[model samples]
Target: MAGVAGNQPLYICRNCKNPIALRSDLLSKAFIGKYGPAYMFSHAMNIIAGQKEDRKLITGAYSVADIYCCNCGEILGWKYLRAYEMQQKSKEGKFIIETAKIAKEY
Candidate 1:
């Protein structure tokens, strides 16, 4: 889902219409918990950094912070795979945002 003008589409919070990310940055689709379908983003904008949380995945991973919408304080997503401190070869964090919570601006 590209954006208007045939460029990167804007991913905005459905509750407040605040910009969250761009479709071009989308990495993959995932279904987690009861949140339904969500998309992984290489990067996200306008996010309020929160606390770090632990996750049990494979060898386990942690989120750098619980991301929230800067405008409405809504839980946008999380930045995960923050094992850079242990494994230098590990990639940086990835942003995972629920597709239901946001809309594509096109």
Candidate 2:
């Protein structure tokens, strides 16, 4: 949070208003989640990653962990721990945050 520019927008937890990610860290808005549209981010903050598990996502099989808002305990999204396929390896270490779980704060 400290490195973010003062004017940069933020994505905050809808339930707790805790700063979750910076707009500059957003990588893509074309991702999908369990509920609906999701986003991929290069980095996230104020979050707690749950247990890692192997899940077959739309893209492929991956080791992911559900991320929660540290302040409110709301399930925000999942972080990609590992990608089984070579083509999907680029997604490793990235964050997938559901659009419905976060809001933009300008």
Candidate 3:
């Protein structure tokens, strides 16, 4: 959490339970990428899998703020952007060290 960012280099997909390791430089882009950005995240994060039933979704669609499920490609969680209000309140007057750590790689 000193140099890169604290997102955990590895996270088990909550959907399929697959090991989701952060890819190297090539696809380091942050939409489900290594350096997660604000837009790639969803305010409401959850995991689910289902097919379309009668032209409708089997698993009601949800959202995530930060990461995605490596197995099912479903959104898993979210991160509070610096501009996000709730985070500002929680981390108010605190220092944020923007660096990558074992728990936050991708």
List, residue by residue over 1-106, the lDDT tens digit for candidate 2.
Answer: 4445487999999998899999999999999998999999999999999999999999999999999999999999999999999999999999999999999988
The top-ranked prediction according to TM-score is 2
The deviation in Å at residue 38 for candidate 2 is 0.3
Clashes of each: 1, 0, 15
Over the stretch 15-106, how does candidate 3's per-residue lDDT look in tens digits? Answer: 45454333221222233223433122111212332331221112222221334443476554333223333422332221111123112334
RMSD of model 2 against the true structure: 1.7
- The per-residue C-alpha lDDT of model 3 at residue 48 equals 32
What TM-score would each prediction reach against the true structure?
Answer: 0.76, 0.95, 0.25
Ranking by TM-score: 2, 1, 3
Cα lDDT, model 2, residue 73: 99
Question: Candidate 1's residue-wise lDDT over 52-104, tens digit each?
Answer: 76565443465457788999998876777466347522435677787778898
Candidate 2 lDDT for residue 92: 97
Preferred candidate (lDDT higher): 1 or 3: 1
Q: What's the lDDT of the predicted structure labeled candidate 1?
A: 0.72
Candidate 1: where is the Cα deviation over 4 Å? Answer: 1-7, 31-34, 57-59, 84-91
